[model samples]
Target: MYLVMRKCDDGFRWLETDLGLDNLDLFVADGVLVGHLAWWSAPQRANVSTGDGAISCETSEIFPSRGICREKTKRGVAPSSPDCAMANLPHGGVLKDLYLRDAHKKDALAEEALRLPAVVLTERQLCDLELILNGGFSPLEGFLNQKDYESVVQSIHLSNGLIWSIPINLDVSSEQIVALGIKTGARIALRDPRDDIPLSILTVEDVYRPNKAKEAELVFGANDPAHPAVSYLHNQTKEFYVGGNVEAIRSPSHYDYVSNRYTPTELRSHFKKLDWTRVVAFQTRNPMHRAHRELTVRAARARKAHLLIHPVVGMTKPGDIDHYTRVRVYQALMPKYPNGMAELSLLPLAMRMGGPREAIWHALIRKNHGVTHFIIGRDHAGPGKNSQGKDFYGPYEAQELVEKYKDEIGVEIVPFQMVTYCPDSDEYMPIDEVPKGTTTLDISGTELRRRLRLGLPIPAWFSYPEVVAVLRQAYPPRLQQGFTVFITGLHASGKNSVAHALQVSLNQQGTRPVSLLLGETIRSELSSELGFSKRERDINVQRIAFVAGELTKAGAAVVASMVAPYEEAREQARSTVEKFGGFYLVHVATPLEECEKHDREGIYKRARAGKISGFTGIDDPYEVPKRPNLVVDWSKQSVSQIVHEVVLMLEQDGYLGSS
Candidate 1:
């Protein structure tokens, strides 16, 4: 008779044995003869085989071997490797003898259950096992009844780093076992159960856990107290501490900006000690500019509040300027601020652009940071659209949302109108303040970037030359440098034609370019798993932007033609390009009637006949440009004529070589 045993971390140990005996006689004292058991005590030392061989025990500091004598002396203790105790077992044949003492033969027959090795279980499985073990069912009975025992065992082995046993009849090779382990999410350590010999090893899978501290260190400097996220967390913890929120005591150390220590709670607390009667927090994604400075200074002076210039230092919308670069810009402009009246702090927050919801969240967070008042600019907390490709909320919606909760949230919401410069007064004024009929400068950040890329000068009154220079230095060259041309208009507005025409002209001019026709190309190119909803449209636009940014970065000009009607989607596209190259807003201004007449694709016809829902210009709203760099009237101009004008515009903007 032969018995099989598994190798343990210490050495070879008995697991499931094939030794046979009658149940009643095996339990009776001195009643029956059990089968011969030839198992290696230390798998590393002995070889198991049908043929006889002399076994020798060799002990060394480096590697120890087990023999019959050692096994007899160390009855149940497993052999240990010099390094790791859980060293894998060796494979191949080993020889040993099974002997039973004459006086203990009956006891050995009754103690057959003790020969089984303990099985390791995972948390979930352990819970199941406990249920069974606590008078629910016998272990052997439960094991036989279980349907998912193998999968459960595999899960346990994978999570807690345990070895598994393969049946001898399976004829499975070490490589096959390893493959199975990997497929089952368990790591494989190749070794023979009979001998502690290692062959190969592999890890099962990668686990992802968010490392907040490491993220903080990377975004903020290793020890920066002024990091807005750190400061906000610290201030929050301190305020909570006064309220006897014991959880605040467990707050982690902040990345200190000043003393360069991992812990900046002391510095943050010191900054909070200032007795500020009125605290005004300025929220911005971009660095300080002349207009921003004017706004903050004026607001501070008017309310007699201490200005807290808080800039978001977290993951912003893709293609927006990097927070680090923005921070450096702020540092450069700090000296220009009035002393004692202004204070600067970094706030690390992932902006959801929830528009109204975001505004409310921002105010609540500021309240936690001990801010009494917050500046709610146009389009606060605004993520552009809903699932239907419609503007979910307006620019003022965020302000109103915050205002609705202000009294309950304990934060004052100050709404600021859009600020623009008055060339006549040589002073900054809100858009409403300017005379009704007076032509507004009307340039947007997108247009500003486009002009800057074209080597055009931005007005000194709108932005400081120094600041503009910094921006130019940070951004790539516009025009000749590959950038995104976002064309937006109604269906049948010649968006695709204009894009193709631009592409053909660019290619003829020896420029490699790619044209992204949203409806025709992108819709089909995206995975079928994506649904056709407003959210899906937004995602499609984002995907297009990402691809365009990639192409632009690789020096290929991109002509992206999409009906990106919503302001937020367009803004996201503009931002994505601004990160790497310039972004141009080309509004294909074709009249609704003209677009309907040119509905060669029959889309507008279908839309008007109630065959289509949420069609732009028919049912859905197309956000007309608040400000576009170049407006092409597709209704009047032919595709060729439009292409020619665009090329000339590009040439004048320095996007193309001199013709």
Candidate 2:
């Protein structure tokens, strides 16, 4: 009996054998005999051909081949070389490995890098550079030049007509452009910001300013500050972008997740060794849970493919769980899957939260990593909500966008089906499959955080105990966590006295260590050279916020008192400190006359006499708190009374227990 299998447009081929051959099976990859497929059971013969050595089997399932580089199967093209034995071909047909592995060549480049002007890479830029060097960002030799950048921003395609959604440009200040003499044809050293170690030397091809508004509007769907990427572009990104091709001296160093960090070439080789030709890649920046596991397993099973749990380890959403904790969660989830069915790997990707556009970008990245299929879930890479609290994108917008270009991308899009737990069956099922009026349970991210904060029980069916244990360790109950009380007002508005009283009260309560960040004391110790200009004050307040955040993360109660007149600076401080712990902004609202009257040091008098220029509330303005948690007037409230009120607020927020 002879069996025939033909490649299908969906990147899978059918298996066929005569009923006469019950015990044996054949494995064919691109019409070439590779091995024996012994895993399938006997199937009934659907059709028989006597003259032609071919028979059709009853099994219509699309089974993946064991040893074949699945290229664009719809194109019916065969692998070009023997080297393409397994794994999917990288996007754009080539895996550009830019790493100079030869010892002598690397040494020469490293020495040459010393002579060129260096641009220290930001965290996000380092992530991009690493991928470029390793070919995870295949076909991208280096940062995008002006032509390609404009094309990508406008049409989600490179200037060459290749689909490249996100623009990868080396952003720099105008000062750096002049100081480093950066322009077309100039060479500059790209160094790691952490250690100043040279990683690559780049030959600049184009230097230009990007139209951020146009880019944000077209690429991100909105130019809203609430979108993290838009906010970053307007607030943080430099003025000029330098584009160039880089010759790598060395890849970026990563001490953690060493075993799981695989370059594109290495990953393809590993997949080939495992004889896995069809891979389904799961992308996540958040920690995995039972729902995620079910979704991925179902997708893989439906596709008859192995699973790759690829999580982003670089900058994610600002408040997302740290990669270390997320990695641990993923590790905990590995054993839950059937053995040898899944693998975990870290992708050092700096996510732009670009919603639909980012979905295509992720698909291309996975395709470059030899992934045949990618899972695009609801609101994939979404940036939460806009300033008006409406979702930035529809739930299925990412899936629809990915679906529109899946064939062109050469990576099948597996739309993630939302799963919920059914206690009646003690299992998870897709939300659509669950019958109406049936009891179902699900946890939202907000609810999970609330439960974790309040030390509430998380049902075992929702997540594994091992995973919950890791999360609990990372996020202790609110009572056990620390908090910061930030006081801001005009000078001598009893800010220091209130801060001191709060510190003493907290210390006496003894739930955690207490830290006091008094403005004058900080000025002498940490900001002696910083004058009281608006800019200097912002810097001083930012330094105070940094220390307070550190203390809060260390499980300490911090009371920071500063004249922080500008609301923007105060808001910045709140954002910084709140990442680690709770932040309470206490506005000391004593009248300006009352403050001047209580100024024992005559600083206000000196400011009135023009001795102190830019004295807040005297020469400079003090923007009143727009959203203070607690407001106290020293003329109406005593220090003890204010401390008691602050303590009550903390207690109510569950930051205090038996204290």
Candidate 3:
């Protein structure tokens, strides 16, 4: 007989009056049965007792939270409650979408049975009770025939579907069990099957229990952000943690970061309520300096819009200053902003350094956050270099690409030229405005850093001394020592060979240089999982650029050979590296026919046979170097001859010295 134990609060009164078995010495062999039964729906109490009828037993009990259970009588005579009302206990609702069997109801019920005051079984003890119970014997017969009381307790705790059961030997301390329940976030309760009484229930508390959808419904109402539910659900994905023992919450997107608990719909409503006719978004990884501030202030004033200074507060490339510090710097400058025109919010976005693609993603994200205009600077998502030590994309490419997607993305792309001071004009002017004839008083961030490190004064016209001091404090001089030599050309255009030759030559000349060969190095250094798609290739190039920047910081000259066919990718690389060390473009001008002839690897030959698509020269368009610092024609020169020319170019550019 499968005797199921159910706990209810109503069983205590019935057992005390109808059965008259409350005070009987209820002993079965060496074990005794004890019950602290109470009614399920009504408040009627019964005390622990040993009944004396056909068996003899002794009972001992203790209650710390409430001292000793008391027998209480109501309405003069004993309360005659219906058994059906008392015994018909409702099961907890079925849990849906059970990812694991361990989360099933049967398992929950088995765990619940162990905490009963009358039983008190450990997980091991519960298993033994199942064996005895399945043998089809009465409680007294089972006890007499059972191997040991401890074994019985262990059996019951392990039994499937057994919600509660009486245990022979209650060895586990209530404190220990309660502590376990608390730690595991599981519910604990004491229950009696015969009396249908439940006592001292404990339940697990939900951590991420906030009603996000409901909150969103209340806040957003009808005005929901685009792909609202999908966006929130995507944010709910988690990462494996604690040796895959548990999952941890992922950082939310930029939209979710500012809105906090409010749903996307509610956030939209909140945005609509604001008297913001025009919303301009400024995207930045660094704190605003004078030039940056000036640019944004002017842009905001021009459009008569409110400036939303949304700074990225997510993972960035290595060696970048922490986001917290950048945010603090912005806070210090907040007071200087015109009243009621500027707003600041942290945007949580993982930087792809994707140059063009990144620019598009940034604009779309700002649009989702209710911004109408987005600032797109040169080289927006620009990652430095590929594992093979090659630049993936150009700086200006990001801006141009974003412009292409502007109408589709539904956000205005604000283009701005590089801001610099013109000494002849005695005023700050965009780089484009500076006359070619006038001596350009251009100072790079790298040069400024070097000057500050050497205790030299930075010209006040170029930047505020306070800003220079802050930059110095943030980045010391030693970290600003490297430069990148970016090589661009078609595949098999002697780009990689020339880069390698340059490395060998630089080393022979007593210079320790790092060389990044785009294709070869990427296959070896980065994870094999990363493929060679246009996007991946772009990412690889950015990573290479980042590494080159680091090497430059270490005072090492970096030689990188990459098929940077696009002008935009090169521009971005130049902008990024020139910010710290310096950038020089070396165009290896090998004609399509000559490049195909030297395609010893048969890459070009395969393209001719239609075996490959997007072949740099044959199939895809290869943008020729419009203006490069040094251009080498492989058709007109030998490998050694080209190497000598490279050395000459480096010496002329101040990368090397004349002997």
Q: What is the TM-score of each candidate against the true structure?
A: 0.40, 0.87, 0.35
Candidate with maximal TM-score: 2
Q: Report every candidate's CA lDDT.
A: 0.51, 0.82, 0.50
Clashes of 3: 61
True-structure RMSD for candidate 1: 24.2
TM-score of 1: 0.40
Q: Write the per-residue lDDT of candidate 2 for residues 153-180, one digit (tens) a residue.
A: 9888887667788889899998999899
For residues 367-407, could you state the per-residue lDDT of candidate 1 as single tens digits? Answer: 43445678998876444444456554676766776676555
Encode model 3's per-residue lDDT on 1-659: one tens digit a residue. Answer: 01111232322112222222323211111011212122233433333221212111112222212222221321121122111111001111110111111122334444454553333333222322222222111111112112222232333211222211232221233354444433234444433333433322323222122233432332222113232221332243221100001111111122333433222122233444555647787988875666677678877887888888877665455456676557656776666688887877765455535455557656755654556778888767555554455555566777886666554555778886577666666765677777777665667767764675554677767655555566666554432345678888888788888888888887776644565556567557863565656666666667777777777767787888888767766776776676667577889998888988887889888889999988777777778767698898888888789889877776664566532
Off by over 4 Å in 2: 1-82, 100-104
lDDT agreement of model 1 with the native: 0.51
RMSD of each: 24.2, 10.5, 23.7
Which regions in candidate 1 have their CA more than 4 angstroms from the true location?
Answer: 1-270, 273-277, 385-390, 431-442, 479-579, 582-654
Which 10 consecutive residues of model 3 have the lowest summed lDDT? 240-249
